[model samples]
Target: MNAILLILIMIAMGAIIGGATNSLAIKMLFRPYQAVYIKNWRVPFTPGLIPKRRKDMAEQMGRMVVDHLLTPEGMQEKFNERGFQKQVIQILQREAKGWMHSKRSVADLLKQYAGVTDARGKMTAYSEEWIDKKLQMFIYHNQEKSIDEMLPPEWKISAESYFDSFAARIADKGARYFESDAGRVQLETLLEKFLQGKGSVFNFLSSMFGNDKILDKLQPELVRFFRDPSSAMFFKGFIIKEWEKLLDQPVWKAGAQLNTKSVARYSVKALNRELTVLDRLDMPIAEWAPSYEEHIINKWIPELWDQVQPALSAKLLSVFDYLELEDVIRERVDTFSVGRLEAMVLAISGKEFKMITYLGALLGGFIGAFQGLFALFFS
Candidate 1:
């Protein structure tokens, strides 16, 4: 019995040592790769499991990321997790505030506004007169025929939607110009003088032309602006301001209900009259169409693009609201990068290996003790 007991103890000790040695050896296989390759000596496969098939390992890792991590379903699952929206909003808010509070933002905004005012003031040096002259020239110098000949044989719904969209776009673009600080100041000053009946931009021009008859001639076109608001946005704004004063109303909503309806009816009447005159007299607007796009493109479009561009650009000054910060931290966090373990866990049967690694010594020791008991019983 003593001899048997001694043999059993020796077996258990040998088994424990062997289990420890094997576990350590397995760990060493992945610890590092590529020992120093100096002179004529080598570590003889000392460099680990990854170095043996590094290129293949890389391709496999990329494949795993694409298949398991970067898929639409996986991404959606992550996005659907709790507190995601709050995290995103917080990040966006922080970024906005950071940008808004930055000194760079102040300098950039100042430069941008300065450039705008400088360019606009220079162009408008005598803009009112120049625009008036150009519009008049367009009205004049036509052949003795109705412009109806240029009309298409049929109207199109698709074409109408396109035209309306283009018109709306033009309206939006023109909206940006007058929304500026300098623009508002100039427009307000001009209207104030006009409404008080103390200022006449026409008077200045009339004096220069040596006749007030030109003012009388332009009465038709000037009245035409109120009738067709889109064509005369600058004047339409003036009309609105004057009406607001007359009504003594703080809000447009507080004014008469018929205001919008009246404006619409007047606009329609004005457009119809203008079209009739255009159809009677030879003018391009009588046949504005997709087919005519090429002709206008080659002729008037490029020639007047610079002057007309202002009518198409709208100014928007964005100011973001506060209370957003968690998003900033989360977006900056949740980025896990574990290198070899990351690659290994994604590979075949390696996830099980990872679980085993945490408790391998304990598990391996238990297995070795069972092996020792079996050896003693058999001996």
Candidate 2:
């Protein structure tokens, strides 16, 4: 009985010591968050293991996250997942639906979202400036080139045909004019002027014939000359000579004749007037694009997603590199307070830690039982 009592006491003592030691050890893992020192002699294990190695742990965790958990391949896989793609498409469709049905005018949206004060005025100014810049660039680049060089190849190829048509029209109009009463009166007046310019002998001959008679003869001849096909050739030759002279002049001379600022302003105005959509800037989007839900939401969105998904998947690695996610995780983990970190760890494994302490007590009690039996056997 006494032996039995001694064994029980030994087991109890062993159990107590083991449990207490383990509990203390567990507490020490997080307690004494800061280093403890006595007059420059630092106490061993002054700070907890977690606290001491927090930075290194943080760095390891960051590497682990980047290397294993949040790898580019993993991210790309997630992006390619059908469920994720569907979710993204659904979200986009919802946004499109909202905007499509919105009663807000484009001007209002621009003012609200983009901080634009006057959408029309701003667009007009921007267009005018763009046009002016383009015109200036064109003038500067082609200033040294003659108009003939500046003209398109197609225009040069068809130049003769255009000249022929113009000359034929001019001859026909001239012949008609000369056959009219107006042409006869004009001819008589011209004859009078010519006879007056000539000597008295020509003047006497003109008087003998009379201005009316002279004009009657000359007017018919003028009409016939204009009616002749060669007359058209004559006008065409004259026009070709003038056109050649004009084409020989440099582009800068032609540009100098234009009012570029006025041209830009008028061009912008004409564009604004002609582009019927600009007039509807103040109208609600729903009113103008009633089929937006049908076209943009149903058809366009899916097509756009299909095109973008592959490209985005391919670029996930680049995106992750740009983000430097490992450093981000490391910084975040390092910045956590020791107490907070301890609490987090405890929250995850508190039950397991208690079981460890209990196991230590059981193992110590078993060893104590064996020692007590040995001592008893020896006695």
Candidate 3:
């Protein structure tokens, strides 16, 4: 009876000590939520391991994310993937299609993108100051190229050629007018006035010939001369030369009242008029969808992406650094409450941590048993 009682007491002590040790260890991981103090002395292991190392952990995580997961090469590889590009293009098409189909006006879309809304929840027109700033940026970018140089050769030729033909047409019309009856009447009146001004010799000759007869005869010959094809051709060539001279005039010096800003403003006004027309905006995307897809895929997309790839590769790292990604991440983590941090960690590793606690209990139980066994043996 005594032996049995002693063994049972040993087993009970072992179980109790083992359970207590494991529970205490588990509590230590999160106890003291903050540092504890005894007067001027800080109690040993007051703050939990995680709380003490939180800042360092945040920094390490930021570095690991940026250096490994979000590296430039990794991002570039993802961007260059064919499937990714196609998916992105499809998403953009869907978004644009949605915008076109929606009842929203262009003003609404602009306001949404610009993040400009009034108290009434209505979108206002862009301020002149805002438009001017945008225009100035555009002007600065294109400042190195003259207007003619900026234009594609084909476009320049097409516009200039229209004026070249217009000059010839104007000249043709003027030559024809000179051969008309009204022109003959004016010429006859001028001739009569000239002869009247000349002294008596011309007047006497004109009177003998009869002024009406001389005038009638001279008028037909003058009209015939102007009606001649060669005369029309000569005038056409002269007008075309003058028009060419006008074309060569510098754009800025072409008119006393005009400057680049005024021109750009006028262009903006014209574009805004077209843009605001609800009729134009109401058209379905499907009407031009095929053409849009074709041009975008074959021409615009390739050309734009070619430029984008180089520019992105060169500046993406600098832009990421400018964004202060590491600081942003670290700050965000630091802002999280300890409770939240604990919850997050537990959420991720709760099972493992629970197993660790159970294992600690088992180990402590074996240690206690061993001690109990030694004590009993010595007794």
Best by lDDT: 2
> Mind giving the per-residue lDDT tens digits that candidate 2 earns over 1-379?
9999889888888888888889899988877999999989989997988899999999999999999999999989899899999999999999988887789989999999999988977877888898988988898899999999988888877886799989999999999998998877787777777787688899888779887787778888998998899999999999999998988989899889877888999997787678655666788988867665788888999999999999999999899999999999999999999999988988999999999899889977987888888889999
lDDT of each: 0.46, 0.88, 0.66
Comparison by TM-score, 1 against 3, better one: 3
lDDT-based ranking: 2, 3, 1
lDDT of 1 by residue, 23-136 (tens): 565656554556546577866665666555555555555556545655445545545545754465456555544443344433234347664333323333334445445434
Better of 2 and 3 by lDDT: 2
State the local distance difference test value for candidate 1: 0.46
- Model 3 lDDT per residue over 289-331, tens place: 4545656655665566656766776777788878887888888
Which 10 successive residues of model 2 have the least lDDT summed?
Answer: 271-280
Q: Which stretches of candidate 3 lie over 4 Å from their true place?
A: 1-20, 37-42, 112-172, 175-223, 240-303, 368-379
RMSD (Å) of each candidate, 1 decimal: 23.2, 7.3, 7.0
Clashing pairs in 3: none
Assess candidate 2 and give its TM-score to the true structure: 0.62
Off by over 4 Å in 1: 4-8, 35-45, 76-83, 101-105, 108-379
Q: Could you tell me how far off, in angstroms, the CA of residue 349 lies in candidate 1 after the best superposition?
A: 14
Over 4 Å off, model 2? 1-12, 102-115, 131-290
Give lDDT: candidate 2, residue 225.
Answer: 93
How many Å off is the CA of 224 in candidate 2?
A: 21
